[model samples]
Target: MEAANLCAIIAHVDRVSIGKRLAEARDAAGMTQDSVARAVGLERTAIVLLEKGDRNLKVPELVQIAQVLGRPLSYFVETPVPAAVSRRSAPSLAHASTRVLDIEIDQFALDVRALVRLGLLSGAERDARARVPRSHRAAEDAATSFRRRLGLDSQSPVLNLGRVCETAGLYTFAAALGESGPDGACIEVADDSGTVGAAVINGDAGSGRRRMTLAHELGHWLFGDAYDHGASRDSERMISSFAVHFLAPRAGVQKVWSENSNSPIRDRALAVGVEFQLSWSATVGQLMNLALISHAQHDDLKLREPRAGDYLRLGLSWVEELEAPYLSPGFMAACLTGYTEEKLTEARVLGLLRGRLDASQLPQIEARSLEDLRQAFMGHGG
Candidate 1:
């Protein structure tokens, strides 16, 4: 009787530990206990008890809660507890509350953690952050230096910013951060192997706008400011300068300007916008800063922004590849590999993919039953 009572106490303690994690994840997801209860078809009081560790959680109930919280089941069951991810916002969005953005970023980090644990993804060494003074000129110089490091010529357009970032050891993803949310966010996490940097861009933003946000976040990562509690106005300005010059180097802009010397100032700005994949406003700003166009020309050109037709007419297609809630190719590939190897179940794989890939889209595979897992474990015993 005493042994049975002890077993009961042990089980209760486990559930209590899980309850604590659930509460933490709910808060990180910006969900109220009542909201989670409603989403899980439970009464508010039930959620309160569950989180308080006063009640047992069934497997099915936990599964439903996992879906609502946007977390993997393993995250709740894993030992050593999940590390708390810090919220780091872009300077432009420092004023706005980033609860939703924080949720997406946190989920992405969890997915990365799972992949790395499964041996599906390799850990990367942390890159040293660049030190740039709090001046626009210094920022531009740092941008030029970074461009050189990437082996990009002054005239090269970064056709694949996402891939470039990944190659540079940044795990970049996209999330649909609605219209009012931040343009992007970034954070670096440390694991047993090493540290990894991840950034989430607002996939809902325009292609040019999205790319700019990504570049801006990349600047934060390079400057090692993604871990800062809040970005200062001066830091934001320097990073903005770095991003602009990083995307549209002066020498490249000069070359394009010289190529279109015969075109009107407005036309030249459009050409630069297309070539560098910069937003209309950024293009005009670059032209003005380069002294390629007068301040008055800059003002007029900004108003006479290029239309959608202008981009299509100029042979630039709207690339939806980076749309929000999207995963990087490498990450997606690792998830798929883990699924095919029977290391991850369908539900877990779907969670890791963030619903970007449907179950129907997944390749059919025979999943191991509980008995099979038990037998495999027994076989491994000496």
Candidate 2:
């Protein structure tokens, strides 16, 4: 009788510990119980019961939750590595209607945090936000700074922003957003430690749009306020303004922008668009914003929008077709570092990559030597 009683007590304790860990993991991932329940195909009561230690957890349920939270199942059995979230953990999305994307964004940020906590991702070298001054010149100065750091002037086209962002201590990676998903989202891992941590840019967009989104997300990281009920008027303007100047600097635009009425404005927009690898509309809009052209002129340019063939006629290659999905080379390097050091297991590393990346992209992670078993024991014990 005593043995059975002791067994029951032990079971109860384990349940409670698992419950506490689940709650913490969800918090670290910045997801609410409702969001988690919805993601894992459970009722809200199920998540509540699991967290309160009032219900027994199924193995499948625990595994599902681990993947959804972007955590390892082992995390629940052991004391979890604490997540280092910015005091402001909410994401600053360029597209406001992104409730559909909350699950993936939270998971991505928390996963990166886990890797950083494990020392896989090295400490951030610098904070892009610190480089910008808090004045009227904020956007312009930030654009100049990024350009200078990227080894380019306004006259030079940004051939690849994914590589440039890595130089600024930002990890610009891609996450799959289904056809109807937001263009991009960014989460800056801020700690009291002052390391810029990391950021991911959604890359399921067209290649040109992907570059624009990376610059837009940079605006969010540099100057975005925490999740407001709605994007405040001033905040959205600044982000858009920053993206414009950063990706298509005013000086660079003037150098490449043609004002010849005889030459089709669509051709002009396409020319600049091809060079900067940005959306034609956005490129033209920046020109209008700089007062280089009138609003009416922009409208007229839109009328004869250049087709894909038009770009080929000018001997310009289709950049969008040529660019790969925007996964940060730096972040991928860290994952490899952790695996090489045996800090992460083969299954664990591949699992994390498979969850965040597409099948076609899986080969990159697969190519790594995850066979290292040296650090396999690192994850043992709470």
Whole-model Cα lDDT per candidate? 0.75, 0.63
Worst 10 residues of 1 by lDDT: 1-10
Give the per-residue lDDT digits (tens) of candidate 2, residues 87-170: 224354335434324444555555566676777665455442342233436777777776787778767777657666666656
| Angstrom error at residue 121, model 2 | 1.9
Question: Count of backbone clashes for each model?
Answer: 0, 1
Error of 1 at 204 (Å): 0.5
The digit string of per-residue lDDT tens for model 1 on 1-382 reads 0122334344545778778878878997879999999999999998889888898876678778987997766566654313323353234444234666665666677667667767877766444555534788888898888899889987888877887777655677888777667787776656775566677888887777878888887787787864443545578778888999999999999999899889777777777888888878888998888888888888888888678887676565554446777667787888899999888878778877877889999987777899988998999993
lDDT of 1 at 127: 45
Clashing pairs in 2: 78-382
Best by TM-score: 1
In candidate 1, stretches whose alpha carbon ends up further than 4 angstroms from where it belongs are: 1-39, 49-56, 68-71, 74-84, 88-97, 126-129, 226-233, 312-321, 363-382
Give residue 378's error in model 1 in angstroms: 14
Candidate 2 residue 52 Cα shift, in angstroms, is 8.9
Native-to-model Cα distance after best TM-score fit, residue 378 in candidate 2, in Å:
17
